[model samples]
Target: MPRQAKSAAAEVRSLREEIERHNYLYYVLDRPEIPDSEYDAKMRRLQKLEAAHPQLADPASPTQRVGAAPREGFGKVLHSVPMLSLDNAMSREETAEFEARIRRFLNHTGPIAYVAEHKLDGVAVELVYEKGLFVQGSTRGDGTTGEDVTANLRTIRSVPLRLRAARSRGLPERLEIRGEVILSKRGFAQVNAQQVERGEPEFMNPRNATGGSLRQLDSRVTASRPIEMFCHSSASLEGLHVSTHWEFLDLCRGLGLRTDRANRRCASLDEVFAYYEATEAKREELPHEIDGVVVKVDSLELQRRLGERDRSPRWAIAWKFKPRQAATRVLDIWPSVGRTGVITPIAALEPRNIGGVTVSNASLHNMDEVERKDIRIGDEVLVERAGDVIPYVLRSFPEKRTGKERKFHMPSACPRCGGRVRREPGEVYYRCLNVACPTKLEGGIKHFAGKHAMDIDGLGDKLVHQLVETGLVKDLAGLYHLELDALVDLERMGEKSARNLLARIERSKQTTLDRLLNGLSIRHVGEATAKALADHFGDIEKVLAAEPDDLLEIRDVGPEVARAIAEFFAEPRNRQQVRRLLDAGVRPAWQPRRGGKLAGKRFLFTGGLAAMSRHEAQARVERLGGAVATSVSKNVDFVVAGEEAGSKLKKARDLGIEMLSEQRFLDLVGDA
Candidate 1:
């Protein structure tokens, strides 16, 4: 190796060791030795060094944990040893019976030593290491075969990338350890809080959150989550020896695998039951969620004698606690319309706290679930909240249902808008087909101002909602007519912000025909169809004049596109809105393909420009019959790089693509 390469390798190894030590301290031991900022700086430096020296790249390096490019789908991994499931014991009698069965299998009358541990409410995964360096990881899918999730698992800090050396022995050549990947109660809450902030759906429970995180196609997403793991058993332990399960777990911990401190070694069934009782009593106080206690015969020899039965091991059983459930009355059941127009029944419960969270509402999924559960207003219902998610009604007490109890039926007319709702064939959901529904209109307004549509700046979902709810904006045309005072009065909209938004709205009036058409959100009309229509017609008037036959003549415009276009234009309400838009100074125009203005030119932009926003510049290029690209390449004719230009500018210059400043671009395009 070169001298520099040798130094880089040494530094990489040093950084990896430091990062793993910190990870063990923070995640496994709950004691952070270094400040988070300092840790972050080290991670960034490590990543930079790794990127600089590709030959020194190692999957076991801490820098590799942030994840990589998204995969299309997960590859299948067949487990060398089948990942078995555990049979459950719901009560003391059942647990005793399980113990009796194990004793019968072993043919031993003496007190059998057992290992008891928390049955974590988590997803099971198998982590494989070769020569004590992490190589592969997978989900426990169907035991025998699993989805490969090595990248996602590597993102978890508690999962060891490289095993720590034991003072007494050499590292294993190949080791496969099984563990439960979990999210703590606090972590689940934090994740859900982020979800609400992002306007995405909240996960139902910690297990649900963990599962979703693990299954993310983009491992970067998994890296962002608060996920941890606890290794409990081994599938393969080459070059390692232990007499009992308890000893194996200790060995795992010594090798930097996170092990549960809550585990207990019990010499008899009485001691196991005592541990279960204590664990169940202090369950809520535990950092992570556990539904039961897994009791396993400690002796590896005894376990072998009392070998596997079906998918479960005869030596181990999950002695589960009674499910956490509470009784609550259903105050009311109402139908709510969602973004996609599916009408779901939401039940309002008489406020009762379950699993440390106050329960107010539960989604009944559909009318089918409501009927199946026989859930009715004024009926007492048993509710179950798994890991502090919103409680679901387990079953309604039919005997307690009074004559005053009301059965909910899906409304014929939409609740949000008085349009007819109908259940379509093959779908259980009842949908309001009306586009004019307030809920649907809200979704449309968001799409209208989206980047691919009008490219309107500062007009987000929250602002649009405020405009609609305040009755200041009713339709698409209403946006153009928004007064400064009205916008300023809306939530979170200061005068300065409102003015910036108004300026963007004004600039959007000069958009190309394609963007304007796309902003309309006509059914079956997407970006490609809109562009085709714009290229064929060039102006709004010609597009409005073109019949279905004329539309069908265009390339890529099939019968469906033609029909949708015809229907959109034919509607009087839509036509009036288009007219109103034109009156409000919105002009939609484009150059025809045969014309020779700036045709065949491909422009890519980077950084801030003083003259105009990037979208406006792109629109101008398109109007003059030029094409716009987002990346730098030799094929691109012009790279319109401006102030603070980054890597793309250098790349464009290197590739010999013509570079133009804001002024040069304006001069070339005739300053339109």
Candidate 2:
């Protein structure tokens, strides 16, 4: 080998060693010695050296954690030991019965030591490690065979690429670690935010996001998401013996794999119930979603004695939390128009308490969703807060339907303005094509004056209704042209109140481009997309002039979104309204914002930002000429992590993206 090649190899080795040490400290021990930025620099140096000298790259190298070639499809991999599902104990009585059955099977009367772990709501997978090196990973498909997802799994930072040699003294030659792949609550929100920004449907929950991300054919796509894993059990092990489940978890942790920190050892069933109740009480506080707790016999010998029963182990049981659902009768189904003119079917239900809150109505989403679920007026239905938020109609109880039940049909005409309603080809929603529809006008005007938009205080629903009904305001532009005399004529509008509202309207004139674009209520153009467009074009006139192809050049703008933006700008009426607003002193401030200290940088925020909301943090970044990204990616310059930062932080570490503490971020932006 040439001297230069030898020198490169040595440097790569040194960098890899340092990077691995930091990974162990951060992921396993939760004690990071160096700041994430310094660690990222080291990892980047290793990656650059390996890229220049391909022969120096190793499969187990920390640098290989991401940036793999995309595969055509996943191949099949059979589990050496089937990944069995668990039996559930839905109530305290069922849990007691489970404990009695286990004792009978083991022929023991004394209390059995049990390990309780939160049952993560995610997809299960098996990770195979050879000689302390991660080699393969597969999803738990059918509990027997699974599709290989090794490349995607490698992108998850919590999963070790190579076990710590210092802690691998008693490690097995080959280990198959069984775990759950999950997206934390924060990560799930970020993924959904990006999806919406790209004009794609949002994921229902974190579990769905995890499953979707893990199945991506492109490893780079998976790497861009914030996916994580928590190793809980072993599918197969060789050259190692552990007597207790708790001991095994400790061993897994020592090998530099992450285990849930909330796992506890209970002395008796009473202790188990206590632990379950405690965890259930704080379920909403967990970073990752969990549906229940798994109780397993701590003693491996006792587990063997109790043996397996078909699919589930007899010695373990899942104690599930109460379902967040209630049965209610659908009073009626009605159509409502949104700012985008899509007609959504909403079901007014008999008020029922679900998860301690009364839900009087739930969105049926669309006509297709209503038909698919066969929801009918006056029929009994099961209502649940999907993902513990957003009331959803799960299904209808057809058996309980009465003779008064009526089938619902989509309205052929707009209910509010009598406009013709049409469903676009290849789409599931019915839209009102009339731009002057009263419902759409009111919705758009209200949204324009919303808190996140122009923030015109005192111009609420009642006032907006009076303005539209009195024929004083026809569109968003009309708000800027409202006179105090006309407002004073409306009901309950005194001289002082009218003056205050006018002051707010005048104050809204000097707003940012993003806010103005968002207030326009263009189809598929949300706050995030609006911000991206404002940053990319820097002016409203430039955005209006850009073609669909030009708009597609910006990140997260798909063909659908590009078309929507172009169509919105192409409408003569829309253009006229924008011009009128501009003429009425509604100037969108677009001063060049790309020359600040943080210019041309991208930031991802996770966890609770103490000093401000996530939106406020994002606004700060934009004000400083930096862009806020919804997901972690190679292009991300830094991750501003606050308290309880979750999977995004882990992903940033894996991809060698710089990370900053909230204080450090404040300092960088000169706010400290």
Candidate 3:
């Protein structure tokens, strides 16, 4: 190894130790010697250095943990023991019925004991252990089957790879525990901030973030995500003798696993109801996200007596809190175009608390959302913020609906550009018929300059707005026509900044095909679609000539996406714009072929790699000419199995596809 490489390795080792020590102090001991800002700066430096040199980074390195990259698709993993969904008890009557059912099955005389814990609103995953070592983990895909996400699970520090206590060591030879994986509020905020910095769409809630993180193909990416898990139930077990669910939680804690500390052992349904009431009152005060309370039969023997019903275990019931709803009058409903040109209705509500937050605004989602809720301009309605974050109105109060309240009729023309608006058949959204609507132009420019799209630095939302408002930029192609002087004339655009923006714009003209496709901001054409288009077309002009049918032929491209792509290309004005862009020397980037020995073979990764970051590994494989698939199938040549390899690995084995260890997979890439 080079002297610089050895030094870099040492630096990473030192940083990891320092960070780990700090994490122990902060999270476990609740003490911190270093200031948070200083600690964060050091961590960022470590991340940058490690990202630049992946060879020096270890799997346990503090910089390698958090969230993973998004997967291409999710694969099915048939659980060894099915993960049962919970039965919901919305009222006291329902809870009584659930109790009656248990009594009918068990023929018990005394009151049945129940254990109640907060029902976390997040993705369900099963962690399998063999002799206290995390063997596999998977998502609760379709209850019986789920996607493998073992590599990602290993990245969670709270999840113990080995159980402690000399007597408890390997107490269970085989075990599978079902749990909820949630993104912490702190982690979600930090991740969202990073996303904002990168110009990517923010996840609406922690549940969405957790679900997205678990399915990521790159364990390294999963490691970076702030994911935590709470074991709820035992799906399967061997060599263990716990009689009650409450006792089981004690065992879990003894084995160095995490369980909800808020869980209470209730002797009767009255206690359960009281527990629910208490949690409901304090729900807003809780740091993590909890939708409701899960009440389960405490006795393991009694649970077996209750059994299961179709999709859910009859032994457990979830008492859902009412949707945090409030009565509020709609001030107005306004249309806003998204980056992809999808027009959305935003309801301006009378300032009131819905859920916990004081909500003055809520999304109507689309025309469907508006109509389904029967929302009107001036009518008083009930609005709810599910999980206390996203707000949506339910229905208008008939008594409060005065004759003066106006029915909100969606306009037939683009409000800003006077262009005709059209609603497609069977679709709920109304679109701007004019391709060159200033709203669309503004959105297009923003997408073009976005970090995940064109990555054109110096051109921001304010600058794009200025260019669009001034009529200097009509479309993405108009960016090339900009000069430093034109930019300087805009407010806040200094000479140096203007020159920088122009230079960045000029450089963006030469971006790769995927980036160019993303920059175009076609409806339903997101980052994934853009990559698929680039891989298929290999050039821009060919894509313009292709029909909707041709676009539909690509894997994962739906009819809506195809229609959007075709519509974008069919416009003469759009074609002219493309021509102008092409004429300005924007050449399409080359599509690198899968040329090595594993060229035709598809590989899907699950679980954490002990050595390399997922991004580094993916780049390495792609560089050597290998196709990295998102989901597992029979056609997959190999599944790269890592620590906690989940459902995908099992599916691969079931399909008789070869499975490779992380080290072996790395060796293959190195050979290529």
For model 3, the superposed segments whose C-alpha errors exceed 4 Å read 1-116, 122-231, 234-240, 246-288, 292-324, 353-358, 387-389, 457-462, 491-500, 507-510, 532-575, 585-672
- Please give, for residues 1-672, the per-residue lDDT of candidate 1 as tens digits: 899879988998898889999988876667899999899878877876787789988878887788777999999999999999999999989989998998787777988999999999999999999998998999999999999999999999899899987558668778999999999999998776555323345676799899999999999879878899999999999997889999998888778889998889999999998999999989878888899999999999898899899989999999988887789899999998865576879899988877668888887777777898889988998888775456677889999866999999899999988789998776667888787677766767777888988888787878877777777878888889988988888888889999999999898898888999988877656677788777656678766766676667565676866887898899899998889989999988675564437755667889898988786687578667766666665446789889999999888888888888899999987855
Best candidate (score: TM-score)? 2
Candidate 2: deviation at residue 594, Å?
7.8
TM-score of each: 0.60, 0.75, 0.52
As a TM-score, model 3 comes out at 0.52
Any runs in candidate 2 off by more than 4 Å, and if so which?
1-74, 151-157, 160-172, 184-213, 216-227, 239-241, 436-438, 441-472, 488-501, 517-535, 545-581, 586-672
Candidate 2 lDDT over residue span 1-672, tens digit each: 999899999998888888888887887778899998799779767866787789986887887777477789999999999889999999989999998888676678987899999999999999999988899999999999999999999888888988764354666889999999999888888886666444344565788889999999988778878888899999777878789999999989888898989999999999999999999999877888898999999999898788788988888899988888899999999998876677878999999988778999988877778888999999999998745445889999999976889999888999888899998877767889787997788888988998777888887878887898888998888888789889898899999999999999999999988899988888778787888787766667766666566676576786877898899899999998889989998878765564555655668888888887786577577667766767776656789899999998998999998888988888777761
User: Model 2 compared with the native: what TM-score?
Assistant: 0.75
What does the lDDT read for residue 360 in candidate 2?
A: 96
C-alpha RMSD values across all candidates: 12.6, 11.5, 14.4
